[model samples]
Target: MSGGGFSRLPNGTVVVAVSLPSPLGDGSVARFLVHAANRARALTRLRNLGLRAVYLRGNAEPPTPDEITAVLHHPDGLLWRLQGAPAAELWHPFRSSSPLRNRWA
Candidate 1:
């Protein structure tokens, strides 16, 4: 899933899909899949990383089973990309994504 909603795994964790406008103010949306113990924690993880605009919307795009697995196995429990980005685009860890940094410099 790429827009919103969450899925519970067999191990009792959750994978949440969140979409928000990029911090760069470029009219582009950033999508994220986060694996956490629950929904609040998932959002909190993003917020803690300076993504304050993110929130769970309706289940417009829930993470697919495969997408959940991808987030689950990620060490930091997060994967991100620009919405509508090419399929060949990479999903990056939040810390390294340009969207979170101020490009003004």
Candidate 2:
């Protein structure tokens, strides 16, 4: 298992930050606000984008008006760094042995 599983609710928005392996030897991290049914789905989507290192940040249930504003108005910027990896572990949400299997099914 990669980190903890989140509640299977589709009415929330999760903030995801991913670290892209750089070819220049300098890594970069980018943040995105994703709207999904749950954190598992969010992680899955991020993985589908071909990112190997992803992390889940804060989330809001039934996102508040302010939260929406923040996502739309002031998007997160990428951070350049020399080292360090994503904070969260990456796992398949639909693995047969995963607790989230039934939830996705």
Candidate 3:
């Protein structure tokens, strides 16, 4: 599971997740989710290279809106890396008060 998955939002933000191998049962899915978040950290490092945005699908819950907010607003979060132009705006517009118009605006 290295190729990972990509979800391009309507706002132009790209949500990327690591593709961890599923074990065989419920535990597999759970571990995949955990690994997804763990891999998110690795992906964060790529922000400096124009890969700032990511989305973690760790479980059926799809991560809380607040949890996502915390990640984006964290001191060293993705937002910090997307300061200028060209950074991948990896934010979820569905949770925002105003919806996004496209994925590359």
Candidate 4:
């Protein structure tokens, strides 16, 4: 997770940037150069891990050394800079015996 290279997706394709919420609950985020077949699959990976993600516009291609360093050195992780319509903002509601799921189903 600490490397500058892209992470492989489930389908073995390559994407550029992915913004993942921190599992550590330290108010920090994790940014990855993601490898996915497409945007939906990339998002599915994060969603399965119970994470919300965004794609950074500038890093949507293979990141340069400076871009890698900049993301790593970012104070609040990379969530702050990810913007645009292509970004995925997924919300997983708390699991419970609530009737919402049944209604939707």
Candidate 5:
């Protein structure tokens, strides 16, 4: 869990959770997120984990090329930039379970 890499669930799913340090500072909390794989091999690794797919959540944004390189090189030095807004603004209130369903409709 301490390693800076993806983990597998019991269901053969490749889960890349962002295990960045806690307390991102400035009254905001850092959240761990699952990263998706665009490569077929990475997806296969997920399947090997006995999972059909991994669960990804939160308002985490995709890392930029430079950020990715930084993570690949020195994950411990990974630092994310604040967009100067609340994460809730990206999605509606999750009163119901199927929040995204209504969003698509």
Candidate 6:
């Protein structure tokens, strides 16, 4: 388990941020942010997208306001990046296969 949590928008929507080990077994942790109507739906969205073991139990690494806006502005309302990677690194959209590869693995 990396870190994860949820943040709700004033409009009643939620942004869920979770950091998990890359499913690709690349030994790198990747953070996923999902914007949805509710926290449950947000996590479910990721599960449906192929992160089958997804879950949120504590508010350890909730999305910051800026991060929420980034996901909301994105076409798919979903974004991901390597854990602790430089802010200059681009956040990738949801892909069946991860985009992190082994750069930080």
Off by over 4 Å in 6: 24-26, 96-105
How much is the lDDT of residue 55 in candidate 2? 52
Candidate 3 C-alpha lDDT tens digits along 61-80: 33334334444454433322
lDDT of 6 by residue, 1-105 (tens): 668999888999999999888766667788889999999999898777767778898898889887888898998898988777787998888754655432222
Candidate 1: stretches off by over 4 Å = 1-3, 96-99, 102-105
TM-score of each: 0.80, 0.35, 0.24, 0.33, 0.25, 0.84
Return whichever of 3 and 5 wins on lDDT.
5
Instruction: Please name the candidate that would achieve the greatest TM-score relative to the true structure.
Output: 6
True-structure lDDT of candidate 5: 0.34
TM-score-wise, the better of 2 and 6 is 6
How would the candidate models be sorted by lDDT, starting from the highest?
6, 1, 4, 2, 5, 3
Model 4 agreement with the true structure over 1-105: per-residue lDDT tens digits: 222234333565544455444454555544444334654665565454344334344433455554444444544222223223234542222223423222212
27-97: candidate 1 lDDT, tens digit per residue: 88877889999889998987787666667877778888867777877898888878888888877777644
On TM-score, the stronger of 4 and 6 is 6
RMSDs, each prediction?
A: 3.3, 12.8, 15.8, 12.8, 14.1, 3.4
Model 1, residue pairs in steric clash: 1-62, 1-63, 1-64
Ranking by TM-score, best first? 6, 1, 2, 4, 5, 3
Q: Indicate the residue-level lDDT of 20 in model 2.
A: 33
Worst window of 10 by summed lDDT in candidate 4: 76-85
